[model samples]
Each structure stands twice: as C-alpha cells, then as structure tokens.
Target: MSTYQYWQVKFEHPDEDEEELKAVIQGLFNYYEAEYGVRRLTSQVRDYYRLIGKQAPNHKRVQRLMHEMGLKCTKYNRRVRKYDSSKGPNGKKGKNKLNRRFMSDRKYQKMVCDITELKAGNGKKVYLEIIKDLATKQVLTWAIGQHTVFCK
Candidate 1:
C-alpha cells in the first residue's frame, strides 16, 4: 500500500475516554463510508468532530486504526497521468523576464494563454483556449474546438 502524505490533522486529546473515543471514531467512519463509498475521508471526519465540540485525534493513530479496521482508499477507477512533451513539433521557451512577479508597469507587456478541455454531451472532449493581457486583465483572444496543438 502507498503511504499517505503528512497533510494530516494532529491532536492531543486530554479527554481521552477510550470507549467514547472509539464510538465517535466508528460513527465518523460509518457516515463517510455510506456517503462517499471511499476511505479517504479523514478531512470530513475531522470536521465532523470539530463541529461537535470534540478534539480531533492524532493523524498517525487514526490512520493506523483505520487500517486495522480494514478501511483503505481504493484506486481501481483512477486514470493514469499521461502526457507527451516530445509530440509533433518544438516550441520556444521564453526567458524568465518577470521572475514570478504578478505586477507589471505597461499594458500587454506580457500575455498568457491556457486551454481547458470539457466533456460534451456526446462524450467528446471540447478544447477552449483563452489568451489574456497582463496589465489590463483583459481577454485578448479565445477559440473553442478540439485540438491539443498549443502554440503562440
């Protein structure tokens, strides 16, 4: 099994009634399993206890206990991350002129465009390209169709 990242919630419960804590934990897991059909429900369970005036449990303990209870996030229906950088043609990489700054002096000094794909009613992916001006925050151009050919 793959290990989880440590974006986990941690706590030190002073009111450590063992049976009470176990019951609350069971309810949290049960609710999430019924609603989402997924075991990656840590955040939701933490939020539930927070709403009920109870301290959240240590993430390590919760994860260990959940695993003992046979709860795990399944990855059967997950799609693979697939992308090819060397497809078709070459593109120019511009200089790091702005250096991560979000502000500029002159209008249209720099422009950026991004494309998003949406699944249509007929199950076909439709691409939308949006070009924007930096200084004025205006949309310069846009096109809607089906193509992966991103260019300047």
Candidate 2:
C-alpha cells in the first residue's frame, strides 16, 4: 500500500471526533478562502470552538491541518518600489542641460522631452515622444512609433 494509505489505516482516530473536526475545518477553509491566511484561520477556529463551548484546538494544529488539506490564501499585499528617474544601462550620464530651470528666455532655448506609452483599441503597444518648448509652452515636435528608438 501507499504511504498515505498505510498511515491512514495505522493511526486512525475515533470516527465521531475525526469527522466533526474535518467538517468544521473544511467549512472554515471555504468561508475564508479569499482573505484569511493560516494565522487568521487558526484564530477563527478558536473563536468557533469558544462559541460552541468546546475545547479549541491549538493554532499549530490548525496550520498542520491546513497544510494537509491544501487550503491557502494566495493573495498577499505587496509594496511597489519607488520610481527613479536616472536608472538605466546606457553608460552615459549626460549633464542636465536645463538645470531644473523650466523657464526659458528664448522659444527653443530650454526644451523638454518625454516618452509616453499609448494603448490602442487593438491592444498593440505604441510609444509617443514629445518635445515641448519651455518658453512658449508649445509642442515643438511629436513622433509616435512601435519602438522606443525614436527617443534615442
């Protein structure tokens, strides 16, 4: 026989207690599948027994049962990293010509360039490069293409 079958036959508990615990664990697992992890599920199980006035099982026991039954809360909150402006592998750290001065005496003296992504209705990826004249607040030139080489 397989190891699982062997273990099941060798160390079987009384039918009443085993079935009741299994049913309660399954119910709680289904109820909290979206939000609760093992820790919260353990507390919920304890709360359940407290309401029914029965002896609550240990949290580690609940965690073990959850592992055996393949019950898990897959969604976890994650923090996104902050965006950095000067991060790349171009090997050229060119000086900022504008020196953070947005205002310009002449029309094209201090121009700003930016590349933005565009999502079309057909789901194709397109990139748009825009050059703006800082003094007049007008677009000097704009180009759209599938490749980012337009910016380079």
Candidate 3:
C-alpha cells in the first residue's frame, strides 16, 4: 500500500481505543479514592478486562495513561518519626516514686504528669502539659504553650 493509503487506513482503524480505557481507569481511580498507584491500577484494569472477556492492556500502557491523566496516589512516601522526649541530651533520671502503684485512696496524694507536643492548624508547634489526680482521674492542672519551657 502507498504511504497515503497506509496513513488513511491507520487513521480509520486505530490499534487501541485509548478514550474508553482512560474512562475506565478514571472511574476505577475515583472509586478507590485515588489511593491506587500505577501498579495496583494496572492489576485492577487487568481484572476488569478479564471479567468482560477482553484482552487486558499492557502495564506500560496503563502507566502512560495515568501519567497523562495526572493521576497520583495521595499517600505519603516518607516515614514520619514520632515525638520522642528522650532523644536529646540526658537529664538526671528521676526515681520512679510511683513504683507502678497508681491506685490512690485519697485525692491529691498521688498525681501524674505528662507532656505532649501538638501541631496547630496554622502549622505552629504547641506543647501541652497536664497534671492529673490518680484517684479521681481528673486533670488537676493543664497548660498550653508554644515552647517546652512551660513544663518547667
């Protein structure tokens, strides 16, 4: 066939129906809340095709389509380290006066304190310290500050 005839035939009969495939991918991606990456999406697409008794598309094709459609997983890739109070310079270790006996018959006789670090909605760090009565399980005192020095 001549070049013009080949071009006409190619245009008339495309190798793959990309629009239909893209629609299916978009539906599945939305159905999954955009958590499925290319690998899982490709597997889902294969399963869908198998269910319909049609040939499954190649993984590379699925990946390319997802890239073109700007679909990406929302999950973070980095490991977020939790707050550790003992990571820095060592302070004089205090004796465990409670000795694992948290029960108390009288109020104010035994109390426990804890410090927690929190992130505000504006991305600012906030520290919260709480002192509680062991017997009543009530917060005796609580303080919130921008710095850890408030605990002192």
Candidate 4:
C-alpha cells in the first residue's frame, strides 16, 4: 500500500466548514468518552468519526489543525529503552571507527576507546567518561558527573 495512498484526497471543490469539522471532532470525543467510559490507552479519537459516517482527515493534519484550534492531546510520557543500532548488530561492540581500521601491524601503534551512559535515581542523571588504549588494553582516564552534556 502507498504510504498515504500516494494520492491527494480530493474534496468536493467546496469542503466542509472549519467550525463544522471542529464540531465533528468534538462530537466524536464526546461519544468516545460516553461509550468507552474514558478514552482507551491506545485510543485515536478520529477513528470513531469514520465509524459514524464522517471522513477523518490524516493524523498529521488533524494534529496540526487541532493544535491551531487550541485543542491538543495530553501526550503520555512513556518510553521503552530502545536498542542503540549505531552500536552495531546487538552483541557487545567496542566503538564505531567510522572508517579507520582496528587492525595494526605492530603493537602500541593505535588505540580504541568508547563511552556509555548509565541512568540512575529518579531524576538526577549521572555521566561517565572513559578512555582506554586498545593496544595495551589499559584504561588511561575516566570521569563521572551529574550532567553529561558535551560542548559543541
């Protein structure tokens, strides 16, 4: 299927009024509240509009128009820790060379190091910095802090 049907939604030349569209959206929300006894965890209000014989606009368009009309959703602050794909395919990875190779003809010729984050407590974040020599496998330097913002 096309990402957006790959075709513009053609209206009847003269479309529904702005106020009417807002009213339809509001009516759907009211219906959802009444029938569902509060919005469901994964509720998309506009879905009800289509079920009730109303053409629901695209989600992005609904979001934009609703925001312009001072009607916005209270987004839940929920997130699941995502896998860091830049760290390569799963398993333990040292670091991304980007181009430079890790192999060397002689010992102590090159070194590789990496840094990672560890979030702790309720809000106060901690930062850890480490530097190590790949040739010797020796940790050269390390540092930790409450905030880990890097300088531009």
For every model in order, what is the number of clashing pairs? 0, 0, 0, 0
- Model 1's alpha-carbon lDDT is 0.62
True-structure RMSD for candidate 2: 6.5
My TM-score estimates for the predictions, one after another, are 0.38, 0.52, 0.55, 0.33
**Tens digits of lDDT, candidate 1, 28-139:** 6676553432344556657767898888766666676665566654434456533333233454455666688857678888877777767789856777778888888889
lDDT score for residue 64 of model 1: 61
Q: Candidate 3's residue-wise lDDT over 1-152, tens digit each?
A: 59999999987886567878998999999999988898999999999999999889999999998998999887554455454543444655566788999999999999887879898999567889888999999998899987665435
> lDDT of each structure?
0.62, 0.74, 0.84, 0.52
Instruction: Kindly list the per-residue Cα lDDT of model 2 for residues 1-152, writing each as its tens digit.
Output: 69999789757754575567767888987887646888888888889999999999888877777777777776554443332223445745656766777987787787777777777788566778888889999998899887666445
Please write out the lDDT profile of model 4 over residues 16-70, one tens digit for every residue.
Answer: 6556666655665565543331234114545665677766566665555556655
Pick by TM-score: 1 or 3, better one? 3
lDDT minimum window of 10 residues, candidate 4: 34-43
Off by over 4 Å in 2: 1-15, 77-86, 89-100, 104-152
The residue pairs found clashing in candidate 3 are: none
Error of 2 at 5 (Å): 14
Q: Between prediction 1 and prediction 2, which has the larger TM-score?
A: 2
Tally clashing residue pairs in candidate 3: 0
In the order shown, the candidates' Cα RMSDs to the true structure are 13.3, 6.5, 6.5, 13.0
Which candidate would rank higher by TM-score, 2 or 3? 3
Best by TM-score: 3
